[model samples]
Every structure is written in structure tokens, then in C-alpha cells.
Target: MDFSGKKVLITGASRGIGKATAMAFAEKGAQVGLNYRNNIDEAKRTLKEMPGKGHQLFQKDIGKTENCKELIQEFIETYGRLDILVNNAGIFQHHKIDEIDFEEWTQTWETTFRTNLYAAAHLSYWASQKMMKSGGGRIVNVSSRGAFRGEPNAPAYGASKAALNAMSQSLAKKLAPHNIFVGVVAPGFTETEMGANALTPEERERLLAETSFKRMAKPEEVAHAILFLASEGAEYCSGAIIDVNGASYLRS
Candidate 1:
């Protein structure tokens, strides 16, 4: 797990799991490039809290296709090489088929996919290209348990994450020859600002009851899985999906 001299780029790193992962990598001696959108204050706080030097922030809306390219370019220019890329930026919007209007439904699907799936695909392509030239690299994607079970309220969110999982596996197979490894971490409801904001007291209670631990996963817990997958000895684990859901949901 010693990432000394490694360079990593993480998206949605202003807070929650992304922030935790960035800090973990920093502590392990990796120079980090943190990406956040529309949250300069939180991003700055995360940057200041990092334990090491040579870390920088890139404020870009990764939901936009162009920004993904720009962000990777900026990180490469700043860090000289890329060792790991964590595609954690995502959106979860309620777009129940029976509840929302056609326009809103379409828009939600578009926005959700753009942010959750497309951005990750584009970044992986660009990052893996760099990794190919540099000998090897890792890409750890953040998915969701919703991808396996279901998201009655946010179908688009579930679909995007499921698609992300598929894409990661495809890349894992295609990129392995080039020394680029791909893995996924699918977490259930976690204790994060985003997750908290999306649930009511009753809803939170119900979700917690679904887990064996009777509680949500912590951001740091999810980050630990990401780090393990990104670590050097885990090259053989490429294309694997590790669940950090506290046994909230399971699939055969």
C-alpha cells in the first residue's frame, strides 16, 4: 500500500468518500489531484487537510464531456504522470416513471448518465492512455448497491451505476494488455452529506434496518476498498467488484 511517488486523480473529492480516498492516498505518499465541481470552499478544506505536499485541486464540472478531458490534461501537466484514477463523481436524482413529467424525466436521465457514466468512461480512456505509455496504472470506479438490487425512486441513478460496472469490466479486459487495471467498489447507502440529504428520518431508519449492521457504511470504509483495489498487489483483481454495503443487499 506504499504509494510513494505515485500520482492519483480523484473526482468529486470535495467531501464524502472521494475526500476520504484522497486523504488516504496522500497519507500513503501519493501526490493527489482532487477534482470538485461548484464547491470551492469544501474543496479548499480538503486540500488543506491533506497530509502531504504536491497535492492540487482542479475545479471542473466533470458532468460535461469536455471537462473530463481538461481535468485529466491538467492533472497530467501538474503531476507529470498518472498512477491511479478514481471516478467517484455521481448524481442521484429522483425520477420515478409514474411521478415525473416527460421533460423532467428525460432531462434527469441525461444529466445522471452524463455525470455518472460518461464522465467516468471518458476519464478512463484518457487516463488509461497515459498509463499505457507509463507501463501501468489503476482505475477504481465507485458504483452502488442499487445497481444490483433496485432504485425505485431513482431508476436513472441505478442504471448509470450498473452501466458503469459493465464499462469497468469491459475496460478491465481491454486495458489489461496495456497494463491498465480496472476495478469497481459498489457501496450501499453511506453516511455522507449527499446520502443524508436524500433521505427522511423514516426512510433512513428503513434503509438502516436493511443492513446486517443496522447502520450505513462510512465514507472511510468505502475508501478503504478503493485503496485496496488500487494498491499494487491487486493487479490480479482487475475487473472485480468489491461490495462495501455492510450486507445491506446481496446477489449471487
Candidate 2:
């Protein structure tokens, strides 16, 4: 129930679920390391609101492969260790197949995959190395329910998330020997900027109507799930995909 003295890193921590997760960890006594891109002011503002020690910001875009390593490096340099890594940096673009340009499509794929998966992959590798040095650690990859339900026009985004599901499982097996746990949180429609702006009122209504709760979930709800998975309470959880969708994506 406590994360006292734990060093944790949260990517895309400048806003949304990432920011919420950071606060959750900080309040629980974990030292939070935040990663942001081109939003120094907001990142700092958010950091000021967090509740614990070691709250620092590392400006790195996961869209660029190299930044992933740099983020881990800066985290270690700042905190001397990494106890948990939350892969939350990702993007989504809506482009139908016929409307998708060759260049734009490539960029979309790279943007979504590199930031969503590869960055996580590199950081997982880097984090695992650090974890091994300290006996073990925890990794939580932020995925989406769209990975299972499919995005209307964000195919690359869906693929990237689905890939994280597989990747986390693989890494869990690899890192289990070292006591490091790897898992994913596949959130359904949540009240993040992307979620709120992704559809019009009518569209959002339809989306909400599909859920048992008939409303979008708060980011803190999903953050709570992430916190639990990283908790000592969830010590045996590895390669688990915890869904926080309010029954929107339940299998028939």
C-alpha cells in the first residue's frame, strides 16, 4: 500500500492519464520522474502539484528512438535508480486507408510505433538493466482498448498497442528471472484530451452509450489501476493486461 522511497518514471507526464498517474504515485510516497516534450512550463506546473520527493522532468520525445535512452539516463542520473517505468507516451492520427498518403502513412506508423512501442522497448531494456543492478523492478506499458476493438481510422495506433500487448508478455518472461514484472493497462474510452476531442457530442454520446456506465471514465480511475499493478500488492502480476473500460470492450 506504500511506495516509500521508490523511484518511478512516467512518460508523457505533462498531462492526462500520465499526469494523473504521477500524482497517484507521488501521493503514495514514490519519487516520481516525469518525461515531457516541448511543454516545459506545463510539465513544471504539474510537477509542482505532485505530493512527494524526486519530482523532476526530463524533456524527451519517445517518437525519436534516441530520446528513450536519454530519458533513462537522465532518470538514473537524477534518482540513482529506477523502480518503475510507465510507458505512456503515444499519439494517434485519423486517416482512412484511401486518404492516407505514402509519406503521411509512414510518418504515422513511425510516430505511433516508435513512441508507443519502440520507445517502451528501449526503455524497458534500459530499465531492466537498471532493475537487475538493484535486484528487480516493475514496468507498466500503457496500451488502449482500441488495440482490441480497433480504431476507425487509426490502424497504426491500434497495431502499435496490440504490439505492446505481445511485447510486454515477451519481456515479462525474459525479466521474470530477474524479478522485474512487465504488464499493460489497456484503457478504453477515458476522459483524456484525445478521448474528449476524438469525437463530437453525438459521437461521444454513442461511445458512452456503449459502456455500462454510460459515461467516460476519469483518468484517475485508470491511474489507480496502474498504481495497483506496480504495488507490492500485485507482486505476482506480470504480463497482465488490466482493462479499465467500464465494460465497453467486454467479450461476448
Highest TM-score, which number? 1
Error of 1 at 193 (Å): 0.5
Model 1, span 1-252: residue lDDT tens:
799999999999999999999999999999999999999999999999999899999999998889988898999999899999999999888888998799999999999999999999999988988899999999999999999998989999999999999999999999999988999999999999999998989999999899879889999999999999999899999999999999878889
Candidate 2 displacement at residue 19 in angstroms: 0.5
In order, the Cα lDDT scores of the candidates are 0.94, 0.89
* Clashing residue pairs found in predicted model 2: none
In candidate 2, stretches whose alpha carbon ends up further than 4 angstroms from where it belongs are: none
Worst 10-residue lDDT window for candidate 1 reads: 91-100
- Candidate 1, clashing residue pairs? none
Model 2 clash tally?
0
Model 2 C-alpha RMSD vs. true structure (Å) is: 1.2
What are the candidates' C-alpha RMSDs? 0.7, 1.2
